[model samples]
Target chain A: DAGITQSPRHKVTETGTPVTLRCHQTENHRYMYWYRQDPGHGLRLIHYSYGVKDTDKGEVSDGYSVSRSKTEDFLLTLESATSSQTSVYFCAVLRGAYGYTFGSGTRLTVV
Target chain B: TQLLEQSPQFLSIQEGENLTVYCNSSSVFSSLQWYRQEPGEGPVLLVTVVTGGEVKKLKRLTFQFGDARKDSSLHITAAQPGDTGLYLCAGDGNAGNMLTFGGGTRLMVKP
Candidate 1:
């Protein structure tokens, strides 16, 4: 499990509301990533953090923002939740040459 | 954007059948990874191939990276019901641990 955990495994929110999902890891991996998986689209990276306070956008970063204040915590926020933004969010920690260890995942639904 | 195209988006076979999933791309990658995801869980890294034309095996599963580093494949021998899940391939082409994922292949091994 790499000690990676995501909070609020399931959430339902109304459109236009703001939502934040949290990812925590005890392994202290320097690289953290947020990805959303949907039908026909596979997993698309939304954002990633290389180190504390050093975050960068990914291929599908629109409408999504991420912050990493500490090595153990990375948060993904939706400023205005939209129906299209509803999907399963996964947080991953890079395990160097071995690859990534992912959290169980957080499923979000917007109505 | 670098894209990985996976063939046979869906597959259903009886237990003990053999199957292979392909992931191809025109762009070269430094490394490729294979992952398997089951219902209600995040993707689990299966293997990572770094050198071109490298082959690796994990029990019933075999992974291969193309000679040009532009493609990869996963072959399963005697698939079982437990093997039924979504398989994803990702390529690492950039820095900061960014990976581009292919559309997943959903496999069902009926017992």
Candidate 2:
């Protein structure tokens, strides 16, 4: 639970549509990460932010983007959704004092 | 390329059975983490082992980091249906504070 919440627990849309998924945390952590979980591929990092205005691409950052303008919120955008982009997305924050805290998750289905 | 490798891409065991999931790698890490993720949910942090050869136990689940700091293993005793999930291992050893995750092992404990 870790004070983290992800918007739109589930979504289904057609291809080429614009979509945005948000992750908000009550805990002002320094680091936030976005990951996608899939069969066989496990979890692949999409984008992560170390601080406000500081973000970097991860192992699988091609079709997605993210922004962190404030300390407690992070937003992930799919500029043009595609079928391959269908997966479960998760946001996480590094608690510093303990293990990583994860959001519930957003299951997006692009058809 | 991927640094971490996990064995037994999928596993199924009856309740009360014992099982082990492993993560192996050639690159050494400062610490490694184990997580369990259920469908439509984010991966929950199960354990974190900092020092090499460290072993931590929580109830029936035991996690062990290799002495070389390049591998880890998770053992579940008397497995229960509640333990069924996708188990993942992540290695942390970079300044980015990012983790390299394994392909993951999906476990199904039948009651």
Which candidate ranks first by TM-score, i.e. highest? 1
List model 2 lDDT by residue over B1-111, tens digit each: 548999889999999999999999999998899998877678889889999999999999999999999999999999999999999999887658888889999899999
Interface RMSD of each: 0.6, 1.0
DockQ of predicted model 2: 0.80
**Tens digits of per-residue lDDT for model 1 on B19-63?**
999999999999999999999999999999999999999999999
Best by DockQ: 1
The sequence of per-residue lDDT tens digits that candidate 1 reaches over residues A21-92 is: 999999889999999999999999999999999999998999999999999999999999999998999999
TM-score of 1: 0.98
Chain A in model 1: its TM-score? 0.98
Per-candidate clashes come to 0, 0
Model 2, residue pairs in steric clash: none
For model 2, how does the per-residue alpha-carbon lDDT over A7-108 read when each residue is reduced to its tens digit?
A: 999999899998999999986899999999887777788999999989999999998989999988989999999999999998999987587888989999
